[model samples]
Target chain A: MKKSIAIDMDGVIADVDQHFLNLYHSEYGVLFTKDDIAGKTEETLFPEAGAARKFAFTPGFFLTAPVMEGAVEAVKKLMETYEVYIVSAAMEFPLSLTEKHEWLRLNFPFISWRNIVFCGDKSIINTDYMIDDHLKNLDNFKGKTLMFHSFHNVNYNHHQRVNNWDEVIKLLVEEA
Target chain B: MKKSIAIDMDGVIADVDQHFLNLYHSEYGVLFTKDDIAGKTEETLFPEAGAARKFAFTPGFFLTAPVMEGAVEAVKKLMETYEVYIVSAAMEFPLSLTEKHEWLRLNFPFISWRNIVFCGDKSIINTDYMIDDHLKNLDNFKGKTLMFHSFHNVNYNHHQRVNNWDEVIKLLVEEA
Candidate 1:
């Protein structure tokens, strides 16, 4: 059987942090860099809890968000060797569902609809490898976990880290 | 809070049984109608279990399958009054995930992505009403269960039956 890879979307593939920073700048008239909010929660990044929550409910937020650097190419390359699934916890953000679907369709057209999983929980996912940015998702992953570097996860160092797509390709290749 | 309604795909929304019957005819050079397989298992529908399962794995099967009559209008109407969610046990038919998403996009574009759930289990679903073709899905539902008429579920009469979308709309409107 082909080895399967489950990849998170928001931080791992989609550049949600940049989108949030943009939102903060546009809404609050304040410029905050990714480094400024590194290893911090949304409450720390935004002025209030609701301000951060507002972004999730924003229409077209997931669709317009830029893709993470090197994600498209790296995922395509990975697909050649493994069964790749785009696993996203989209249930929390109801508005982002169709936008995320359109985003994946536009950016990673190589991935089939069969491999796209939209759910609230990650523990149900069973794959040989999981590449995600959130510690919460990787914590319960039964497979080898690869922590995709993101500003919010800067403090977490317990798992194997991949800062960029190049590093991801290298680590997976080495494992093979 | 608005009452939430969970709708099933496959036999309930998209007409999978008709699609399978068409495929069986095209593949086996034998004509089989939906009436012939009412209340029967896959083994009874096809020559073997694998033969029945093959249709699900076929590319474009979910995409090409016709939507159930009145599903689009009823679901759209339902959305106006309820927090509608399109729930499907998609994990079992991994190939149908993306195709089902696209099918909904084409047919039920009004339903937001956040309300769409693709999972292996239905027990996790929490809703005020469930419209499904399977007794198993409606059995454990915490809310009112509307059994959509399907050939296989013909014998299942425990729940309130809606033979068509008009009935579904009427029942929901009456509740409102």
Candidate 2:
């Protein structure tokens, strides 16, 4: 039987940090280079206390977020061996659900809609492996945790960490 | 942490059976009494081989489905003790995602969006209890399975069955 892998969307497959960083620069004239963004939490990186809520509620935020480096190809490659399911904690923003759905369809045309999970809490996910940026999601997952590197989770060292799609492929795909 | 209960939307809470019956009569002059529906599968109940695909693809199908008897109250009551999650295998119909989301919001207003899960396969769901109509969903569930009675699953008697929302409450709520 093919082992199943649950992948987080926002900060892992989608370049949410870059999206927020670019938006932060354009919205408030606050510019931070990619080098400056490392090890910073969303709260510390953005000026507004509830910037995530505001940005997520924005109509085009999810639809237009840049895809992470090599995410599209890496996911398709992983499907050869694993039942790769894209799990995104997207329920909080009602508008983002359809937007994320559309984004996945447009960018990851190879991904079947069946493999996409739009949920609120990732704790309910059951898979052989999970790759996520948040501890709240990875900590509770009943699987091998691969902490996808993100500004918020850079300091966390509990789970196996993958800095990019290449690292993920090396750890999961090639190793297997 | 409260024990989680995954509730199927189509046949369990939302009355897809009633919706299809009404639509079938209006669209093709086909009629079936609720009694006539018992012990019949989707293939047997509808004339067309692809009736479910056709009906699900039809615009506003999930949104217009009637709520099963006492489902709203029963789910709300279950939430007091269980983390009631509305789990719908809605990925096959992309058009139905937002529609189902809106349907739940409009009908079960008390249900938080956080408690909703939109996915393709029910196998990945991790919860303490699962209430669904299809064996495909309930059979592999690690949790205690409560087969919500529907015409399609009335004959397959592997799991404990609940004929209506009242029976669901009796088996899950009062028994607890």
Candidate 3:
């Protein structure tokens, strides 16, 4: 059987931290740096939880967000050997749906529409491997977990970590 | 808050039973009809469960299935009022993912990509209403469940049944 890999979008493939920082500056009139957010939730960066959540609800937030460096090439290379699926916890932010779809089409056109999964919980995903930034998603995953590096997840050390897509390719290639 | 509705694809919107029957004829040299599957699982229709499962694994199976009559117009009208989401138990049939996505794009272009959800279990879905053909999906749903008519669910009468999209419109419009 071909080994299937489920990859998270935000913070893993897409650069959500940069988008959040930009949103934070515009919405609150304050400059927030990645160093300040290291090992902290977005809610901690904002005055209230709603303010951070509001940014996620903004239209085009997911679409306008920049892709992670080397994500496109790495994903394409990974697709050659593994069944790659973009599994996102998108149900919570309903506004991001169409934008996320268009973003994927523009960035990773090779990925089939069938490989995109939009859902609330990641626990239902049954695959050989999962690449994600959040511990909440990785903790319950039944497959071998690869923790994609992110500022918020800097403190987590439970799973094997990959700082960039190059490292991701190295790890999976070695496994194969 | 706007009422949210989750609709099932296979039986409620897209006609998969007919497609499976056609596949059964071609694969096994046996003719099968909707009547043969009334209140019975796909396993009963085929010589073995593996044969029926093979049909789902077939490429282009989801894309080629015909849409339910009046579904396009009814869903378009419903989208004007309700926050509609297309939810499918698609994880079990990983091969159908991209085909199902393209099928939706061709049939329901108005339905945004964000509103599309493909997962295994329906119990995790949080919505105000659900229109599904399977009792397994509807029975555990937290909100009002409208059972879309399907041969496999003909014997199930626990939830409110709608024979067609016309009936679905009447029930939902009345509630609104």
Candidate 4:
């Protein structure tokens, strides 16, 4: 069997809190910044938003945000031996998902768009390894979980903590 | 405008060569396997296997092969905005690329079977981004380029080589 890696999108690949804040400002008439969202609970930010607040948990949030540091390099290394999959909670249309795959293709051509997965329940993505920033996701992930340090998730530690692609590659490659 | 991500099947996601090689070895007199067909050049491997080679390159190649890693993630990411398209080159008829897409949906549960593109030339994809393993396809791709790494391509270093999902996430986040 081949080694597989499933990475999260939001805080791991991009700083999606600002995008969510912007989205909330437009969608639910709320205002917040990345700094304000960090370490804060959902109820604290959007006491009235309810389900709309859950939109931040979706893959589209990160898919539409800016890039994070060393994200590209980390994905490149994982693709060499493992079947890299993007298991996110985005529930939008297939067309939008396809566009993000194309963007990844253009910027990181070596990664295969075919293996990408866009779903809410990541537990279904049965893979050998996973890298995620959400403590909830890391807690529930069925595979060997690697904890990616997030700006707000610094306190959520336990599973292996990796700061960059170098550390991630070292952990994954060392196993091989 | 929204970001776009173009995906190719066959060798990128499905092992069409292996599918055909197995079929040929079992049906015809050909005795090639994935290892025999993957690393070697066409001239060295198929001096007498022209018809079989052509069949393999055609759409019949996507018969029941698996999706590569991180394909689901990347697709979900791009699907956030742009029209996610499956631009593939397959056999003309009943060996329909649509069938391959149907199979893909069953495995992925993320991409829609209808969003598939089963054409010969991706030049019409005019997409903002394209992900394909074929080096020749680089000429046909518009916008940025993301090259999938193959074992045969040991020295295949280009401006945009994405061997893993880290590279893919990095590229998408940067572009978004």
* Lowest lDDT block of 10, candidate 3 chain A: A90-99
lDDT of 3 by residue, B66-137 (tens): 999999999988887888889997766655666777798899888776678886666656678999998888
List, residue by residue over A86-165, the lDDT tens digit for candidate 4: 65544333333444454455555665445555443453345678888777777776679988765557666678888766
- The TM-scores, chain A only, for the candidates as listed are 0.94, 0.94, 0.92, 0.69
Question: Which residue pairs show backbone clashes in model 3?
Answer: A97-B114, A114-B97, A114-B98
Q: DockQ (C-alpha) of model 1? A: 0.12
lDDT, each prediction: 0.81, 0.88, 0.83, 0.61
Over the stretch A1-176, how does candidate 1's per-residue lDDT look in tens digits? 67888899998899888889898899889988888878788667676767766886788888988899999989988988888888888866655666777788799887777677787666646678999998888998878999998877888799999988899999887556
- Give the higher-TM-score candidate: 1 or 2: 2
- A best-first ranking of the candidates according to their TM-score comes to 2, 1, 3, 4
**How much is B23 displaced in model 3, in angstroms?**
26
What is the TM-score of each predicted model, taking all chains together?
A: 0.58, 0.93, 0.56, 0.42
Candidate 3 reaches a DockQ of 0.11
Local error of candidate 1 at A121, Å? 0.7
lDDT of 4 at B66: 54
Clashing pairs in 1: A94-B114, A113-B98
DockQ of each: 0.12, 0.81, 0.11, 0.03
Name the runs in model 4 displaced over 4 angstroms: A21-36, A42-63, A92-96, A174-176, B1-176
Candidate 3 segments exceeding 4 Å error: A27-29, A47-49, B1-8, B12-116, B119-176
